[model samples]
Target: MRDIIEPEFEIDEKGRVLCKTHSNFEFFSQPKVNRYQQRELEKQLTCETCSHFFNDDCFFPRSEVNMIEYDRKKRNAFKCKLCGNKIDRMLTVMHKLYYKEKYNIELPLICCTCYETLKDGKFIESSKWRSNMFLYNALYAIYSLISVLFFILVYQVRIYYLLVFLLPIIYLFYQNMKKRKEIKEGMRYYQKYFIDSNNNNIR
Candidate 1:
């Protein structure tokens, strides 16, 4: 069983919950998307994922916690990069640091499953991938639809004339398929990896 510490937040002077432990509270980590759409301003700022409420070092009442990520995290709308599942857009301080240290890339706002998958060493070179596979999926669907159209046109007397139009469509699909393969290949892992819990700073 994972030992997730209870959320350690404190009431501010105004009696509002707050956590001032992040490396930079004013960091430009929030995406250009609708960051404030859902009402979790307090949670986002406090960052329950951190072990420190404000960098409590030794000798003092220090902050400490184990590593725990989430899916169905908040009632916000953000999509996962791998499975294309809906997720909240809570880019905690840990995620930002992890991305920079591990992948040397920007932290992607992913669902819990994808985050777990990444920690388990099934994903790498994530920067080459996309946040959504919608365009790739649309390409595949269009190719299938065009194939059905080709079948219907094959029986027509103007089949030769229709071939010219279908040829261009087929080329486009081929290019998109090649790009899709590249995206999937980037997610392949060279070896299994695991993130050990800090118990103090956490993964």
Candidate 2:
């Protein structure tokens, strides 16, 4: 008799994965792409929602697409230009070492696996960069949530004097949420584009 694999509980025991749909719960629950990728992708590709080939005035502004195509002429299929993994997303990277200086060498399409692994830590950022990022995510993301609760408490207390104190925190929270929305939009844009492309291919 074959053994059954039971559903696994979430780390905090808040939920359980019961099927294929639930396998990537966290990844699905939230946006996939980050802010940096969104800004970069927008700068390179056409309309994020457009089904047409991503060749727009914005695409490869720093370099010629024909030259990039020539570079990959030997390759028969799309793959990560950096690690040779299957293409998941396009990344327009500035290559200082590859050319005279200040050149956009757009060939590498990053796979999702690599994106997840390289998005964090010293792998992609310097120590100072990581430290600033930590401060932002920790200070703003966490403190903003805390401020919401504090706002309610202050309001119930009818403490008008504390309004001055709470307003700044509220403003910061709003800014953070705005940034979060942009990042989420970016993720949704790319995920939908790729998924739709795959579906069309299958059809």
Candidate 3:
């Protein structure tokens, strides 16, 4: 239920949920942190998967979050300093901000994949990310197949009202297309900043 959101038939459905850490704390006040009180005093944490964290509500980098890809050529378009792989923009920034705030150390670009590495200094991206992604895709494929079969059956029967089954499929497709556009443009925008910053750093 919390993993995905289904938008209305006629409306744009973008899933927005706070990561566990920030879910406790909203805009106005700090969420209750019993053992984390000391850490809370130092700096407010940001959710790496949220676009709003970057002050951009126009785009949700779902691709960056889901990162569903196997092509090595497309790995980490913005190479992470740690793994030299495509990295999540928000995760990198979140790591930077957290380190700067907590340890007073500035970190270079790091990916969510490198989290365990950073934690244990092992430099190995956990396989769970890929495994979880595979699971999601497998489930998605099942959904798509069912949708196609349902659509075909309903169409062949020429049932008028039963076409409602297709509505969810159609709605999701449109929403997917809409988010794909946003992700495409969002990557470009992030790429521009990456280039500029890289150039500046090199200078």
Candidate 4:
């Protein structure tokens, strides 16, 4: 079995849930898509029975992915340069660091699995700090201790003060649980995409 880490999704500055492994395609790695080039790639890719067909238009004749089917469909969607799978997600490969246009050109739609394998399982970006359970646990411990001390030393008469003190911790715990549930749901979507009916990994 291939040992896989549970993929972590980071909330970007734009509030998008993005995978951790992000990278630029190598400088000379862009694909050529004329008939002759497609023929060449097809011979090498036929072992996997996958298509390496490319077009300037979108790869999917009709895709359920909105950004792919609509926004980027005509202009940016193309065959994945790596495995030749239908482009599902595009990775920003080129850009000006100092200029406003952060991503000038995006690579073909390379799925997350291929991206991970190509990068040798190194995540380029990370937000695991947001979900560090130990940190939350420590905060919970400290909060509980402080609440008990405050109740005993300051507000002993009204038991309601303890509930008031504990409300923020309760809300924090709720938010943590909600985020964990969301992550689990996201992982399920990835598993669905990668696993096929024959139990073979498609990506």
Which candidate number would show the highest TM-score if scored against the true structure? Answer: 4
RMSD of each: 14.7, 21.5, 16.8, 17.4
> TM-score of predicted model 4?
0.31
- Off by more than 4 A, model 4: 1-150, 153-157, 195-203
CA shift at 94, candidate 2, in angstroms?
2.1
Q: TM-scores for all candidates?
A: 0.28, 0.27, 0.29, 0.31
In candidate 3, which residue ranges exceed 4 Å CA deviation?
1-158, 200-203
Q: Residue by residue across 1-203, what tens digits does model 1's lDDT show?
A: 43323332333332233333443333323332455622444445534434343444411123322132333344323444454455443344344444565569864445555565566655554424452353565476586667767676776555665566566666766656654554453344222122233243433
lDDT of 4 at 48: 17
Instruction: Estimate, for each residue in 39-64, the C-alpha lDDT of model 3 and write its tens digit.
Output: 45223433432334343331223443
Ranking by TM-score: 4, 3, 1, 2
Q: Is candidate 1 or candidate 3 better by lDDT?
A: 1
lDDT of 1 at 120: 63
Better of 1 and 3 by TM-score: 3
Worst 10 residues of 3 by lDDT: 6-15
Ranking by lDDT: 1, 3, 2, 4
lDDT measured at residue 176 in model 2 versus the true structure, 0 to 100: 52
**Which portions of model 1 miss their true places by more than 4 Å?**
1-90, 93-111, 116-145, 151-183, 190-192, 195-203
Q: Clashes per prediction?
A: 0, 0, 1, 0
Give Cα-based local distance difference scores for all models.
Answer: 0.44, 0.39, 0.42, 0.38
Over 1-203, each residue of candidate 2 has an lDDT whose tens digit, in order, gives: 33322222222111211122223334323432687754543343311222122333332322443444444444524553323444332222112122223244432344444354435522223323433454476467557657666876867755664665577766765665544443344344444554477677633
Q: Is candidate 2 or candidate 4 better by lDDT?
A: 2
lDDT of 4 at 144: 83
